[model samples]
Target: MGIRMIHHICIQTEKYTESLDFYTRILGFEVVSETANFHNREYNTWLKIGDFMIELQTPKAGDKFNVWSSLNGGPVHMGFLVDSVEEEYERIVELGYKDFKVKNGKIVYEVEGESLFKIKAPEGTEIEIRDTDIK
Candidate 1:
């Protein structure tokens, strides 16, 4: 088998609506698809950011959980490529999301990247924005 770029990333959120808004409004992602699994009693929402997609899932009551926790420092977070890291950094700051900082002279929106500021999303998930070709 050959390796390829990431097709998508799945994140579990107790606050589905808040996560959705954070991705769509704050991070400038759009919803591509959504489905509800009756048998599993879960909801999945797919969000598109550039060429990559993120799957937000909500587990049913009493279901065995396997996603990020709201309390335990959250998930590993996700990275997003931007045309200009500085531009995105300023935009994120104006949007009023908390926990914004710069590191290594690069604008980081999350702790996942080695450079710049880290931006924390509403669901406690961080979104790291970097200057790279995401296409």
Candidate 2:
């Protein structure tokens, strides 16, 4: 069987509201669908803007994973394909998001092809901005 495109990417966050704002406002992701628990609290949310679909989910009260813990040392990080890495990088910075690509307020020049940048999500997840259309 041939491989199809990625249907969605699931992101687990502790601060749901902040994460929602970061994705929708900072990155311009649109909420296409959502699922809430018995108390009408969001348990899972599907956000999309183009062919890309991102699912934001939060762990239960008795869940094992502690979302607040700093797991920044982990190598697992999600990447999003943007139209222009430089432009997206600037926009993310303007939105008061941390630019992990910058050093001491100086912007380093990136190579021509296969470029990428990083922006920290509200939940401390590294949201990568990649300059490629391959999904």
Candidate 3:
């Protein structure tokens, strides 16, 4: 089967509200839908960024799970397209998120003619930002 594109990514959070705020305020995502599963005792909120969607969920009581640990080494990194890598890097620093720096103005990945900058999320998830179009 030929895949088209990624539909959405689900992330589990300890606190739903806190994660919602971080994605909405810091990462610039807009809420598209929200619901609470009463039968399962879980909560979920969906946010949209460009053509992608991020689904945030909170586990039910007595659920044995840790979101951060599960995300380690998974294919779940989200990349944001930006105009300037330096500007976005500076903004992330000013916002107080611990970030990995690129030494000597190095770019993370080169695709086509674009420059990439990778940043880590509050939960140590790597996010790649492309300053140019990927061709």
Candidate 4:
């Protein structure tokens, strides 16, 4: 159990501008990262309050689940902070869990230099295991 904390929660939204304003202006969350046309989405933004974060993503061009067709809002995934991503990935493999995101023959992937891996929960929520020691 190297997990340190619940890192962040992701929210998928069609009202990107409105949600961004609500989180930043109304709720007073500060933007940590903001990228346009990220992963084929209109915007991918990260807002934070102290150590915890909220990831807001606009609907992708071809979302398999039709995320926007329903209510157009809700959580998509959650990230957990870990002491060491490599150790956690190894532990997960040793525990016999077979489904997780992999890149270039490695289970751990890097996003903006942060090491992490994503796995789907039983009800289809994505869970990101991430290393907390960011340089």
Best of the candidates, TM-score: 2
Of models 2 and 3, which has the larger TM-score? 2
TM-score of each: 0.70, 0.72, 0.69, 0.47
Model 2, residue 129: distance off in Å is 1.5
- For residues 1-135, what per-residue lDDT tens digits would candidate 3 score against the true structure? 898998898877666776687678767899998888844757788899888998887777778665554246667567788888778777766877656536456645455656677765554455787777655
Give me the runs in candidate 3 sitting further than 4 Å from their true place. 37-39, 67-73, 99-115
Tell me which of candidates 3 and 4 scores higher on TM-score.
Answer: 3
How many backbone overlaps does candidate 3 show?
A: 0
Q: Against the true structure, what is every candidate's RMSD?
A: 5.0, 3.9, 3.9, 13.8
Which candidate ranks first by lDDT, i.e. highest?
2
* Full-model lDDT for every candidate: 0.71, 0.74, 0.71, 0.71
Model 3 scores a TM of 0.69
Ranking by TM-score: 2, 1, 3, 4
* Candidate 3 pairs with clashing backbones: none
Model 1 TM-score?
0.70
